[model samples]
Target: MCGIVGVVSHQPVNQLLYDALLLLQHRGQDAAGIATNHSSMFAMHKANGLVRDVFRTRNMRTLQGNSGIGHCRYPTAGSSSEEEAQPFYVNAPFGITLAHNGNLTNWEQLKEEMFKNDRRHINTDSDSEVLLNVLAHEIQKATVDISIDAETIFQAVTVLMRRVRGGYAAVAQIAGVGLLAFRDPYGIRPLCLGINETEQGNEYLIASESVALEGMGFRFVRDIAPGETVFIDNDKQLHTRQCADNPSLNPCVFEFVYLARPDSVIDGASVYSTRLKMGEYLAKKIQREGLADDIDVVMPIPDSSRPAAIQLALALGKEYREGFIKNRYIGRTFIMPGQAARKKSVRQKLNAIPDEFKDKVVLLVDDSIVRGTTSREIVQMARDSGAKKVIFASAAPPVIYPNVYGIDMPTRDELIAHGRTVEEVCREITADALVYQDIEALKQAISDVNPELTSFEASCFDGVYITGDVSREYLDKLENERNNPTKAAKPEDAGRSQLNLNLANEG
Candidate 1:
């Protein structure tokens, strides 16, 4: 998943957008981009790096505008290339610049349709680019004049929503017109609106998470509903419409378990509260199974799992200790490109405190175990740090199915729990004991916070694709394409380097 933010303000928004991206840096680390509109022209800067490293003073100076959109990308759909760094621009039908979060399951078919039927060229393999082109085409069709209004924009989104199939939350800037934001019909990804009452007028901000909005001093408005579209015009007026035939609110459960920041709230449920609830349930399960009898202390894997670990320790009446000191410099190992890289980075990312682990029976809690590479390394580190026994617990249930929505876990073989039992996975990770949260318990954790949340997009645990599109055949195709080395090794185009474009109706 990526992080996308857009705002329409009376003041210049380049720095505001940059600060928001920094708050959302945890969502994506591969690439960062920002695009702004000035005088009906777009100025954009994007590159493959952390948010702070990607944009310099010179780059920020180039982006001068009162309205803009930003994206921090985590490569899930396409190859990690500079060319795919987003705020993808299409210079037709009022010159649109879009930054998107989540993957398009049917991007290949849509790409073919774009070339054969729509006659629009797709520059990169990134699905965000395809989505942008599709929106541009629909807007072109819906418009009767050179100028577009909220009705035409909403109509275009209505058609676009029907054609697009995936868990996506997008923010797009329509040149001089306004900023537009929308979420998929299933609400699989998060998108929330916020307002800042300025002296000049009311400035609106749309973001993938609430933290981005709050960190930028915007008051938390309600989340953008599933299949809903919101447009903020240059005059700072907000126009909204529900544009889907049968919209539902089945948000991705993984966001609470691991993806989202603990401080952020999605769909009216606090992410921090959900994680704490996960810990409580997981603690009870350990108690039921008599696994808590020998545990001397509970320790988190660092960062994301801290909240769950804290609550779990409290419920089990076990001592909670910070055994691992995480290195702030290293990127998250889970989203790293290769197995070797992830495995190697685990050591560099976290170091065990020997005093906390020495002669102690440790219960190590992690958000979830996907490939088991990092888990294995972490377990080994604990053992070597003088722990008598390493009991591993996952706050989330076993991820047995491929998450086609937005997460990076693709092939079945890459998932340690895909065909393995709990004992088998424990052996693979070299943990003395392994415990996982039950699927129902996981669901209840979120619903406990907000009773309105009855369902979730939890395909990884239950294999229930809410979109009704992902099939066994589709999964097999994805696995084959991903597992094949040659097919996955497409090189980045030469001279594509970092982008600093000034697009001005130059299709």
Candidate 2:
């Protein structure tokens, strides 16, 4: 997954984009980039690092514009190369620059189609680049002028919706014309519109999460509807069109479980409340499974799981303790590129509090266990901290399938629960007892609080892709691509300790 932000304002947006990217840094840490349009002249600077490390005063000064877009990239569709960093730009179709959150399942086919049919050559393996070329091609077909009207822009988006299959929340700048943003038909990824009204005028921003908007002192407007296009002209006028006839609003359930920040609201559902309910539901499950009696203390695997762990301890009437202390400086181990890197980072990222675990029957709660690597390491850490017993509980149900929408898990073989029973997984992780929330219970926990969010894209747990196009063959192909050594040179693999890249010239 990635975080994308766009702004159309009266003043220079370099600092505004930078501040917004800081809020979204959690969504992606692999790479960051910013592209701004100054009188139809595009200036872009992209690097392979966190937002703070990537952009400096010199770089921000070079990115001079009132309207701009920024991106924090997590490599789901491309290799970790500086060439793959986005806000992908194209000189054609009026110098369009695009950034997006989520992955396209049909990226390979679209890339081939762009080469063969559109006569466009994609330089990088990044799917966002392909998406940009696709949009540029469609827009060019509609009109070859430097400026296109809202109707023509919407028409191009309609064609894009027909061609691209999978989840995407995209924002693009049409140099001399306007700023355009769109969501996929399934609404599998999050995107929202915000407005900041000042004496000068009203500034518009589109972000992957509502938190970024709220953080930048913008009024929270409603979410951009599924398959909807919003075009903001140079005059700051807003135009909207629902391109898809029958669009479903099934946002990814994993967003609530782990991906999104607790402070954010996604698709009208409060992420914090959903996680609290998940813990309450898991408490019931623990009681039902008769595992509540053996637990002496409920300990959280710091940060993301704290809210759920607090709620779980409250419901179970157990002592709540912060057993693991996370190092704030370390990046998230889950988003690390490779298993070896993730495993190595786990120890540096979190350390057990020996006083909390000593002589205690500890029930360790985490958001979810994907590969079991981190879970096993945490269990071993608790044991090494002198815990009498270590029980692992997950707020989410088992992740048995690959999440092809935006998340990095693209292969079934990498999942610990893909072909194993709960007992077998527990044994593998070396937990005294493993408790996972039920699939139906997880759905109920998230939906009970928000009636409007009736359904979700629970593909990882239920193995049901809402798009209804994912197949075994397609999954195998994705796995092969993920495992290809030549294409798998991640930033961490290159021994870059700071994880920073300066690709200003490449853009």
Candidate 3:
């Protein structure tokens, strides 16, 4: 997953994009980049690091423009190299710089098509680069003259939608023309529109979440609808069109269970509210199983699970305690690249408060258990803290399938619950008892927040790919490629920490 933001403003947007990227730092930490368009010239600086580390004051000063896009990238589809860092730039049929947030399921096929049919060559292994080339090619086909119009842009998007297969939300800056943003037909990823009314004129912002908009002093307008394209022209005029033949609302349920910030709202559903509802549902199940009475105190794993833990404790008539003290500096372990990095970071990320766990029947509530690396380490921590019995609970259902949309869970072997029963997984994690929220309850938790949202991309939990393209053969191919390193793309040299490319003019 990645965080992408675009702005069309009267004032310089370099600082604005930087601030917005800071707000979305939780979404991605692998790499960060910003691309700005000045007088139809694009200036870009990107590197494999956090947003703050990637852009220096000198780098920021060079990125001069009123309209631009920023991206914080988490590598789900490519090598973790500076070359793979986005906003990828293509200088054909009008310069275009795109920062995308979603995995393209058909990227390899599209890349081959681009090379053989479209005569376009993709330089990097990043799917975002392939996506950019596709957009540039479509725009080249759509435009007949030197200048392009909103109708032509929408037409190109319509055709592009027909070709690309995946869940993606993207923001692109078209030279001096406009800032464009669009979401996939399934609405599997979150993207919203915001507006800031300045003394000079109106400024538009599009981002991965609503929090970025509100944090940057822009009022949340609404979510960019599924398969809808919105363009903000050079004069700040807004034009919109439904670019897909058929569109549906199926935002990823993992966003509420874990991915998104609780304060943000997606597709008219409040993430915080949905998580609380999940707690209520999980509480009901625990009561049915007669496990509520055995728990003396309920403790959240910290941060994202706090809302659910609070509501669950309230429902179970138990005391809610903060047993783990989280380190503010540590990045989220779930999004961390490797198993070794994630395992090592658990202790560094959170410390156990012995007073809270000592002599207590501690029930620890986490958002979900993916690989069981963190859960096992955390359970051992509770035992070492003198807890009588450690009962682990998840606010979400078991993640038995790989999330191909944007998350990093790629293989069944990596998922603890993929081929194991609850008891088997509980034994593996070394927890005294394990209670998982039911799948139906998980869906109801979100639907209760917004009745209109009757469906979701719950692929990881239910193993149902909403895109209808992921078959058994496709999954097997993915697993084979991941396990066999020789089949995967070799990583570039790790000597340089950053790369700054001038896609347009230097001066």
TM-score of 3: 0.96
Once fitted onto the true fold, the runs of candidate 2 whose alpha carbons sit more than 4 angstroms away are 144-147, 485-507
Q: Model 1: runs farther than 4 Å from truth?
A: 485-507
lDDT of 1 by residue, 151-258 (tens): 999999999999999899999999889999999999999999999997888999899999998999999989999999999988888999999999999999999998
Residue-level lDDT of model 3, residues 377-495, one tens digit each, is: 99999999999999999999988888788889888889999778999999999999999999999999999999999988888887778787776556666776788856743334222
The reply for model 3, stretches above 4 Å from the true place, is: 488-507
> How many times do residue backbones clash in model 3?
0
Over all chains combined, what TM-score does candidate 1 have? 0.95
What is residue 276's positional error in candidate 2, in angstroms?
Answer: 0.3
Q: How many clashes in candidate 1?
A: 0
Estimate every model's Cα lDDT from 0 to 1. 0.92, 0.89, 0.92
Model 2, position 458: C-alpha lDDT score: 87
